[model samples]
Every structure is written in C-alpha cells, then in structure tokens.
Target: MNLTGGIVLYAVLWFLTLFILLPIGLVSQEEAGEVVPGTHAGAPHRADLGRKMLWSTVISAVLWGGCAWLILGGVFTREDVMNWDQLVR
Candidate 1:
C-alpha cells in the first residue's frame, strides 16, 4: 500500500480496536448504583480513556505490523485472492 493507504488502514484499525475495547471491564453507573442526576444509568461511572487509548494503540500497532508484513512481503497478493474462483473450479 502507498503511504496514504497505509495511514488510512492503520487509522481504521485503531478506531476499530478502540470500539471493541470500549466495553471491556466497563463500570456503568447503574451497575455500580451510582447513577448521577439527569444522566443515563448506562453511562460509564468512570471512563479510563487514557488507558484504553494506550492499549488500543499497542494492539493496533501489532495488528497493523502483521498486516503490513503480509502486504509488503507479498504473502497474499491481489491476484492470489482474485483467483479464488479459478482455483475452486
């Protein structure tokens, strides 16, 4: 992938990882019996955004590195995936 493509890929991966990790070990206000006035009970009691971001970055970097290795190393080229039908036939 080109520079822009690589950046876009990493960004997408990072956000996806963040979303997946968002709910893990979460403490909702309702769950903790600490719902504040005018706020939804489902709201997080305390969002550890910094730690989640750090973990997301680390995990995304590893995932991006593996993908980059596969792509840059030509382990699975476009033609390889494109020829799936032919191979099956």
Candidate 2:
C-alpha cells in the first residue's frame, strides 16, 4: 500500500477502535450510575471502567497497528488485505 492508503487504513482503524471503545466507556459510566451531572460517588467503578477502556484501547491499537503494518508493508497484497472471505476460509 502507498502512503495515502496507509493513512486511510490507519484512520479507519483508529475510528473503529474509538467507535468500539466510546460506547463501552459510556456503558461503564451508566452501569456505575455516574452519568448524572455533578456527581462523583462512583470513583471505584469509574476507575475500573477506565482500566478496562485503557486495556481495550491498547489492544485495539496494537491489533490495528499490526494489521496496518502487514498490509502496507506488502506482507499481504492490497487485494488480500482485510478480505473477509480469505480470513474466514
């Protein structure tokens, strides 16, 4: 893949990662009943949620980074990259 392709791939991956994570963060807050305004009582759950989010963020980053590297480095051709059929088989 070219530079532009790599940028687009990275952007998409980052967006996907954030998309998956933001909801989890929201749900964690909601579960902890910390979504209400001007409240700070759920510090323990909030911290736990933050840790979960952090781990998820790190895993997503690493996975996507590896995929991007393999794709852009020509380890997999553009046609083969992210091909669900190929992966499923």
The TM-score leader among the candidates is 1
Best by lDDT: 1
The lDDT of model 1 is: 0.95
Kindly list the per-residue Cα lDDT of model 1 for residues 1-89, writing each as its tens digit. Answer: 89998999999999999999999999999999999999999999998999999999999999999999999999999898899889768
**Local accuracy by lDDT, each model:** 0.95, 0.64
lDDT of 1 at 52: 96
Model 2 C-alpha lDDT per residue in residues 1-29, reported as the tens digit of each score: 66886677666766676667654644344
**How many clashing residue pairs are found in candidate 1?**
0
Regions of model 2 farther than 4 Å from truth: 27-61, 72-74, 78-89
